[model samples]
Target: MFSTILVPIDLAEPESSHRALDAAFHMAHEYNSDVHVMTVVPDFGMSIVGGYFPEGFEQKALDGTRQRLDEYLEGAVPDNVDVKGHVAHGSIYEEILRVAKEVGADVIVMASHRPAMRDYLIGPNAARVVRHATQSVLVVRD
Candidate 1:
């Protein structure tokens, strides 16, 4: 019985998270749980990378991501489901974990794509979240 479900999705590749979102919704409906959907805006990896962009670019990106997250939930989430949206900046897995703790999520439902050789070398965000999260995680394959 999950009372709070947190789903982290990549808006750029929303199709990747469809199954996970559906699974979270199903669980939410079953347990009358609140759903927290989140997306992360990755920071420019280096200070030089930041210098390449104009001032306030990060803020603009964050604002735009928040808007997109809200629009995504408006269309995807059912009216009956109690859902909240979060937009974060920084490492995807870290932001997800932070939000999960912030929201007191009981479980996290997220999507994982088929592994590629590169993923084996450098783990994907889902793998990182699975390994690091304090909460239970259910990874839906895409």
Candidate 2:
């Protein structure tokens, strides 16, 4: 029985998260839980990389991502569901974990893509979250 369900999705590839979202919704409906949908805007990682972009680009990116997250949930989430949206800027998995802790999420439901050779080397966000998160994680395959 979950009190809060956190779902992290990539807005650029929302289709991948459909299964995960559905699972989260089902759980939320069953337990009368709150659903928190979150999206992360990856940071440049270095100040030099940030310099390549124009001024105010970071703020614009965050603002745009927030707007997109809102618009996305408007159609994706059911009217009956109690849902909240979060837009974070940083390492994808870290942001997700931070939000999960911040929101006191009981579990995290997320999508995982088929692993490519590169994923083995660097690992995927879902994998990282599963390894690092203190909360229970359910990874729904895309």
Candidate 3:
């Protein structure tokens, strides 16, 4: 049982995270806990100093992510269940950890959708968080 459950989502592959969300919800419902669902947009830093996006590109991504999260909650999160949605820009592991501490989360539930190239070298973000986080982590491996 947990007081707060953190569910991390990858906007590109939403389906991959369904299982993790289910687990988080199950635990939340059973314990009457709060759920904090979050997604981190990888910072596509500017090409050089004093560089900026092409006319609202950054806002477009943020807006899109928020809208998508809204739609996802409308479809996936039950109406009676209380959940908070967060969209942030940063390194995935760091953002997740920050949210966890900010909320004083008892546990974090996330999904792993197979490894790509970079994961093999430095390990996946989830792996890093599991090793580093002060609270508990439940990584739902596909």
Which structure among the candidates has the greatest TM-score? 2
**Clashing residue pairs in candidate 3, if any?**
none
The positional error of residue 126 in candidate 3, measured at the CA in angstroms, is: 0.8
Ranking under TM-score, best-scoring first?
2, 1, 3
Which pairs clash in model 1?
Answer: none
Model 3: CA > 4 A from native = 45-52, 115-118
Q: What TM-score, to 2 decimals, does candidate 2 have?
A: 0.98
Q: For candidate 1, lDDT tens digit of each residue in 4-71?
A: 99999999888877788999999998998999999999988788989989999999999999988888
Q: Ranking by lDDT, best first?
A: 2, 1, 3
Candidate number of the best lDDT? 2
Deviation of model 1 at 68, angstroms: 1.2
For candidate 3, the per-residue lDDT at 101 reads 93
Candidate lDDT scores, in order, read 0.92, 0.94, 0.86
What lDDT tens digits, residue by residue, belong to model 3 across residues 50-141?
15557677778888999998888778887788889999887789999999998889999999857888888989888998999999999898
What tens-digit string does per-residue lDDT give for candidate 2 at 1-142?
Answer: 8999999999988897778999999999899898999999999998889999999999999999999989989989888887899999999999999999999999999999999999999999999999999999999986
